[model samples]
Target: MSDPNGPTVRRRRLGGELRRLREHAGHDQAAAAAHLECSTSKISRLETGQGLAKAMEIRSLLDLYGVTDESERAKILKLHKNAAEVGWWEQAEFEEILPSGLGVYVGLEYDARAVQEWGLGFVSGLLQTEEYARAVFASLPLRPQDEIERLVKVRMQRQKRLTQANGPLELWAVIDEPVLRRPIGGPAVMRAQLKALAESAAQQNITVQVYPANKDVHPGLRGSFSLLEFGPADPRIGYVDSPSGNAFLEKDKQVRALVATFDRLRAGALDPEESATLLNTLAAEEN
Candidate 1:
């Protein structure tokens, strides 16, 4: 079985532990930085899982945090060691195409058992066919043909987790109706994409819901977002990408709001069966 605790997740775990330890010791990032003789920004990065900490640094932080339990120290060190490893997405093939924010989001998604995604203007990447993805990328201004192909490959690779043996991602995607009718790559691409979408929806691990366009006002109107849940132990995280910028939301309040919004969106959308029917109807129309 593949280990779900990849480098990214380990980094996050180590950071969370360090943050907790620092808080418990009644010391702030400044104090931790002073103890390690590093800048506060470095401390912040380590605490937020954005940067890896050396073993010595981890030890020093533990000392500063007053963490005395040998077992706990060993655990933290192990996490640090594991966090140093590289994930598949970090490979050369995807290095240039996977933006930093998207890389982090992918890492989180890899560890997550399920994802609830709200698609506003496009089909969720997890549900998009290669041609459709290429068309979508090509539509963006200034995107070269090579970059478009690389991005499409990355998107397709991400879908592998859907069929992973140990644990497949349970995807619940709520898509907007217009996205299905948009004809991104033209009629042929739409037909193939919609047909593929219908087949994917038939899978046991996937659920599709189509939000009708007539419903003018909806909670997801704000933008497209995805909520990734890593089971009961870890808190869910929300991801949002827009024209302005992209962000990963970790606060309970922020995540909860997205959760509620997703619930409302799904509630207003066509159910799984109806959604599949719509996909089929759209595909046939393209014929």
Candidate 2:
């Protein structure tokens, strides 16, 4: 079952560990579920990080798998307990979709060695200026002012990970030119956003590219997506957000296809230097 509350990074980690253990023991989903006396679907969901695993359930599975090492078993049990802990977003009461998941996403971003993003609509969250983010939030229909403010604040906080003391997170972003020309929040706000984009592009750790409307072909014409490449310990993952909800892709074949599509889109987009010039020209037009 999908957790309506969303899964935490700890939960994701635990799920990964559980998957490794099951594979090491040569137990398929049906075999593991049978050992735990649960539905195979339940084992599948737990391994995929779509649902939480109870401590006792985890313990039972570990025992059934013949895991006799006390240290390893305790470590796995502790991870399960941590996974069940509440995240900071749960305290805010914001109605944003994936509130709990956002915390995990942010944590992943913080640790990721490199991030590649492509957007067909508005700017990616990490690239948006505070003003742009606030305007975006305000445009949401009938949102409470307090809730909107909270969401904007959360977004801004997430951006600090890209600029703070631990050192910049490597970022490469490709956005449709139409996103720049859409005049979100009117001329003044749009101009500011364009300028912000130019400034961000100047940063050594960030690369911003634009795919003009006149481009003959591009893979990202379909929709927005992001590919996050983590350090050695974690696998690369692809994320796509839509009206229904966010989808995370981790299967090797699917992620490889997404990466290939992004590479093609990049090939068709303006190079970083040219993209910066285009942003500056657009900003000048707003003046």
Candidate 3:
């Protein structure tokens, strides 16, 4: 049940807290719903940040789950109040209910001290050129041109955080070799994109690596993911996106596994110096 109203940042935060409470209590959707006298589907929706949980309902659920810590209770209650607040994105008519995990993505991006990403099929949104972004959006059927432009602009805005005067985000990204070879909007657009990437890589806060097809082995072959290291305010979080939606790996075991995989992949990928050489070589070919 996607909410046409869209989720507010507060609602997203509450949803995340609810999920943590349920997981900590060892209760699945059915069990939690039974305790709350609601349908399991509703519980699932609330946990995923797709819908809001009534404050009273959240209170009852927390009490029933034996969550006794006063500090924790206040935090969850505060989140419920916050979810009622609106965000700037909500002002846009084209706003759709982004997956619940997307809230986590935004939250982490805002708070992360560092971020590492790897992409296999296309350029990561943070680094995508306007033409590249347009081409990617064009692949979707029936999107209004206005909405496409809005999205592109929104994406460009996100890059500002990386260039802010105060401590900008420390970003490291690696792309598969095929990503460079495929002309997203044709040679002209790709040439510019490659050149842009090469230039951006020179920034002290940014590191770009390339994993060539000839690499003997790499853990990234499993799929693309990101590891966001937060400041003391929050713990590290890992994210994996798929066509259906996204998943957050927060549990120690899962986060560790993904981190290990990323480490292995990084070791196998081209070093920064070598990767720059590869980028320059490809850019020359395009010219």
Candidate 4:
């Protein structure tokens, strides 16, 4: 689906093609940059999709690589135009306040075709209700009330992807028992949140699983992570947040490991059907 990550994904796609063309022509990054009279960093950025390339710039590089095919050239040029478009978050003034790491994930999340998340803390951001979200944000102790509210607003806006016009983004989330049991925002908020969780799990595109806390050892004990699957043409993105630090994994090896891990977790956790029953039970127990 076309989403906030459109521009970023486009740049990366365009960059990959340029990189392939350069390599096939036997001109390394430095050589290509020298030939094009641009800095090597710019060449690097363009090939890695870290920055946008202008139409003229792309054409020039194509010409240098001897790409004379009109159709291929047109396709690449189209990518440039699409890449220049910005998503709603990018247009917001408050975007500057979001952490760079979080900002990157949020962009990717919006464009993802589906998200597979394992939550060890509270529920995944996509599943967080407004009151639950507010309470969780308030506990952070870093941002002021207004800033926290702004962050909450952003989270709420992002949830729209699950029910937006094009189609809902598929969600397969596995929550540990404690996640459903914990009363983050007090009994009322927790009860509503779990009720919402049960309802969300019922959606066709969403799958909710529960991992038992009694498991002696499990794949998820390593840590909580999320794997975002985008269009088949795009690479998968993996994210891990822990006390150690946060990382957004893009390399194939890193992503593959996380994907395998999530798979194992899904396999071990209670299936959506049983999970819904567990969720409802927990919600009813809340005061």
Query: Across residues 1-287, which tens digit of lDDT does each residue of candidate 3 receive?
Result: 11212233345457777888788888888998898888999997787555777788988999877889999899888777767655444444424633345644754565567888888888777788888888888776777788677767666766766787777878889889999999988998899898888888888988999988987667787788999875453457789988777887778899999889878777778999898889888989998
RMSD of each: 1.8, 4.6, 5.2, 3.0
Kindly give the number of clashing pairs for every candidate. Answer: 0, 0, 2, 0
lDDT of 2 by residue, 1-287 (tens): 11212235566678888989989998899998888788999887798665787788898889877899999999998778767865445454532533535655665565566789998989888899888898888887887888788888778876776786555677899999999998888899999999999999998889999998997766787789889876455689898877666778899998999999999988889999999999999999998
Candidate 1 regions with alpha-carbon error over 4 angstroms: 34-39
Whole-model lDDT values for every prediction: 0.88, 0.80, 0.76, 0.85
Please provide, for model 4 over 1-287, each residue's C-alpha lDDT reduced to its tens digit, 9 standing for 90 to 100. Answer: 54634766767788898999899988899987887788999998788766676788788888989889999888888878887877667767557767665765777787788899999887999999999999998987578888888889899999998987686789999999988888998999999999999999988888999998887787787788999888877888888988667887889899999988988888889888999999899998995
Sequence-dependent TM-score of model 4: 0.85
Candidate 1: what lDDT? 0.88
Query: For model 4, which pairs clash?
Result: none
| Candidate achieving higher lDDT, 3 or 4 | 4
Deviation in Å, model 4, residue 79 alpha carbon: 1.1
Candidate 1: worst-modelled 10 consecutive residues by lDDT: 1-10
All candidates: TM-score:
0.94, 0.85, 0.79, 0.85
lDDT of 3 at 23: 85
**Candidate order by decreasing lDDT:** 1, 4, 2, 3
**Highest-lDDT candidate:** 1
lDDT of 1 by residue, 13-55 (tens): 8899999999999998999889988899998878777789889
